[model samples]
Target: MGTYFIVREIQKDQETGEVRDGEIHFTDSNPYAIAYAEESIANRVIDLLREGTSLNNIREMLQNRHIR
Candidate 1:
C-alpha cells in the first residue's frame, strides 16, 4: 500500500457567481479515502485578505513561523 495525494475543486454559491475554494485531499491506497486531508486554503486567503495581509507578507510570515 502506498500514499497518494488528491486535489479537488470546490464550488460555492454566491450572489455574483460560483466561487472556487482551494481544497486539498491526501489519501492512501484505500478506496474510501475521499477528502481525507481537506484544507481550506481559499478560506484562509479570504481571512488573510480581510486582515490586510498580502501574499508576500503571508509567505514571509509562514517562513518566519517555520510552517514549511
Candidate 2:
C-alpha cells in the first residue's frame, strides 16, 4: 500500500466575498507510515501559508512536484 497526502484549504475574503480553495495530493510507497506523511505535508502547507504565498500558488507548486 502507498501513503497519501491530502492538503486542502478554504478561505474567504471578507471585503470582496471571494472564496479561495486549494488542494493538493502526494502519494508515495515510501517506508514511512501514512500518519507521518500527513503530518509532514500539513506542516509544509502551514509554512507556505505563513510565508504569505497564495493558496492557488501553493497548489500549483505542489501539483508541479507531484499530484496524486
Candidate 3:
C-alpha cells in the first residue's frame, strides 16, 4: 500500500471540475479561523474518488488555488 495523509476534507472546484483539498482548524497562524470547503464540492470530489479518478489528474484541471 502507498503512504497517505488524512485531512479535514476533500473538496472540488465548480468552475474547473477539479478535486481540491481542505483542512479546518484554528491554529496559531490562523487563529479564529473557520473556513469549510463547500459541501457540494466535497460531494463532487467524492464522486470522482468513487469513480477511481486520480488526484494528479484533477490537479491538472484546476484554475484556482483550491487544488494545491
Which one is best on TM-score? 2
lDDT of 1: 0.46
Please report the TM-score between candidate 1 and the true structure.
0.30
TM-score of each: 0.30, 0.41, 0.36
Q: Clashes in model 1: which pairs?
A: none
Off by over 4 Å in 2: 1-37, 66-68
lDDT of 1 at 25: 40
- lDDT tens digits, residues 1-68, model 3? 22122223558899998987564322223333222234444445545555667767544543455542
Clashing pairs in 3: none
Clashing pairs in 2: none
Better of 1 and 2 by lDDT: 2
Residue 39 error for model 2, in Å? 1.3
lDDT sort, best first:
2, 1, 3
Model 1 regions more than 4 Å off: 1-43, 66-68
Query: For residues 17-51, could you state the per-residue lDDT of candidate 2 as single tens digits?
Result: 99996544344433322222455665676567667
